[model samples]
Target: MADNSSGGESTFTVLLALGANAAIGVLKLVAGLLTGSAAMLAEAAHSAADTTTEGLLLAALRRSGKRADRQHPFGYGKERFFWALIAAVSIFVSGGAFAIIEGIRTVLGEEAEQTLAWVAYAVLGVSFLLEGTSWLQAVRQVRKESAAEDLGFFAWLRRTDDPTVVTVCCEDSAALIGLLLAFAGVGLHQLTGSGIWDGIASLLIGVLLTFVAYVLGRINKGLLIGRQADVRLVRSIRQRLDGHEGISGVVDLLTMMVGTDQVLLCARLDFDDALGAADVERLCVRLENELREEFSDLDEIFLEPVPREDPDIRARVLERYGENPLSTRSAPGGATRSETPSGE
Candidate 1:
C-alpha cells in the first residue's frame, strides 16, 4: 500500500491547506499594504500561489476518482500526477519566480519606510499558526501510512503514489519556511532601517520554494511515466498466486498503478498439468475473484495460462521478474515449481 491515501483523508488535507492559505494570503496582503514591507508582499504572493495549487490538487482528487472507461482502460488515476506536476510548476513560477522579481524590484527601487510594522508581525504569528495546523494534518497522514510497513517516514514519502497528499504536504512545508523568512526579514528591516534585509529574505524564500518545486516536479514526472506499484503488494500478489491450488508456478507478473487505490495486474502462470481448458478458464475466473477479494485495490487482474518452456515469454518474464525460471529449479533448464511460496 504505497499510497493508502486513496480516500477522503487526502482531500481533507488539501481542503485544510486551501482554507489556511486563503485566509493567510488575505492577511498578508493587508499587512504588506499597511506596513509597506517587501517581504510581506512576497509572502502574500506565496500564500496565494499555495491556495491555487491546493485547488488544483482537489480537482486532481475528484477527476482521478472516476471508474475505468472505454476511453481509458487503466482509469483516470494518472490525472493526480498530471495536476501535481502543474501545481509544482505553479509554485516555481507564480510563487518563487514572482517573489524573486518582487524582491529585486524592491531592493532596486524602494526607499520607503515600513509603517505599522507591528501589524505585519501580528499577521505572521496568525499565519504561522494556521500553516502549522495544516502541516500537522499532512504529517499525521504520512506517519500513519508509513508506520504500517515499518518504513522510515521520509522513505515512504519519496515513493508515495498519491500525488495529492505529497503536493499538499510539500506546499504547506514551504509555506511554513516562507513565513519564518518573512518574519525575520521584516524584523531586521525594522531594526536596521534598511530594506535590504526584506529583499534578502524574499530571495531566500524564493530559493527554498524553487528547491521544493524541483524535487516535486521530478517525483511527479516519474509517477506520470509510471513507477512500480508498492513492493508489499507485488510480493503479496506473488505469494497469493503461489498458494492457489490451480497454479503450478508463476511465469510472469506485471503490475501498473493506474490510480491511488487501483492497480492493474497481468500474470502469466503455469497451471496444474491435468487441468482441461474448461478447468483453466474456471481457475482464471476463480483466481481473479480471490485476488480482488484479498486485495481490493486490484482494479483488474488478468491471469493467462502459459507453458513453462515459452522461449519469448520466458525472456520477458526474466526481464520483468528479474529471475531465471530455469535456474530456479533443482536441475539446469528445468522449470521452477511453486507448490509453496517464499519471500525475498
Candidate 2:
C-alpha cells in the first residue's frame, strides 16, 4: 500500500540522517576541542540538533501511520506536519541561534585562534564525506519517485507533496554546506592567525541554516493547510470522464490532495437526455467505478449530472467552473433555462 511504502521510506530516511549526524557530531566535537575553532564548535551543535530532530521525525512517522480512530477521523497523518515544524524550530534555535552567538564572540576578539588548526580541517573533510553520502541517498530516493512522475530532481524536491522527503533533503544539504563553511573558517584561521575568520564562518553557517529552515517550514505549512492537486492531474481526470459513455463532457472538476498519494475528486458531468434520470444514475455509477479502477489512490468522488440538450448549460457551467463542461448548454430562451452561470 502507498501508506506502508511511505512509512518505510520515512523510517529509512530518518535513520540515514541520524547515522550521518552521529558520525559528524563525534568528529566535530573532537575537532572543536583540539583546535578550539568556533566554526567547528558551531558545526558540532548543528549536528547534535540534527540528530535530535531525526529521532523526533521517526516518532512522528510512526504516529502518523496509525489507523483512524473515533477521536481522529482523518487518522494521524497531520502528525508528520506537526513534527516537521518542531524539527525546523529545533534547527533554528539549536543550530542557527547558537552559531550566530558564537560567531559574534569570535568576531569580538574574545577568543584566540588555535595554533594547531589542522585537526579541524581533517575532521571537516571526513564530515563532508559522510554528509555527502547521506545527501546522495536522499537525492536518489527523490529521483526514483520523481522519475515515475516525470520530474527532474530539483523540480521534484520543490513540487513533491511529501514533506518528510523534502525536510530530509533540505537538512542534509544545509549540513553539507555547513561542513564546507567550517573547513573554510579553519583554513582561514590557520592562515591569518585571527579568530575572526572562524567567527565569520560560523555566522554564515547560521544564516544558511536559517534559510533552509524557513523553506522547510513553508513546505510543511502548505502540507498542513492542504494543497490542491496538480492542475495537469485534474485535466487528465477530465479527459477520462469525457471518454465515458452517456457522459457528454465534463462541466466542472475539483481535486485536492488528502495525503501524499491520496486525492479527493468532485466533478459535474453532462448526460444525454435520451438517458433518463435512472439511466444517468447508472452512468454515474459506471463512471465512478471506472475512475476508481483507473486511479487506485482516489479516495472520494462526487458526480453531478445536468441535461445535455440545454444550449447554454455547458456555457453556464464552464463560466462558473472555468472548465469545459462535459455536456452542451441550452440557449437563452428555452424550456430548460440555464440555471447556472453560462459562458455567454
TM-score of each: 0.90, 0.83
Candidate 1 — which residues are off by over 4 angstroms? 2-6, 108-110, 320-327, 331-344
Candidate 1 local lDDT, 1-344, one digit each (tens) = 55454468888999999999999999999999999888899999899889989999998988988877999988898998899999999999988997898789778885778899999989999999999999999999889887866878888888678877788888888999899999999999999999888988888888888898998999899888877777788889888886789787777677887777778898888898899999999888888888988897788788889886667876665555465343354412563532212123
Question: Which candidate number would show the highest lDDT if scored against the true structure?
Answer: 1
Give the C-alpha lDDT of model 1.
0.84
- In terms of lDDT, the poorest run of 10 residues in model 2 is 335-344
| Model 1 vs. true fold: TM | 0.90
> After aligning candidate 1 to the native by TM-score, how far in Å is the CA of 33 from where it should be?
2.3
lDDT of each: 0.84, 0.78
Q: Please give the lDDT score for candidate 2.
A: 0.78
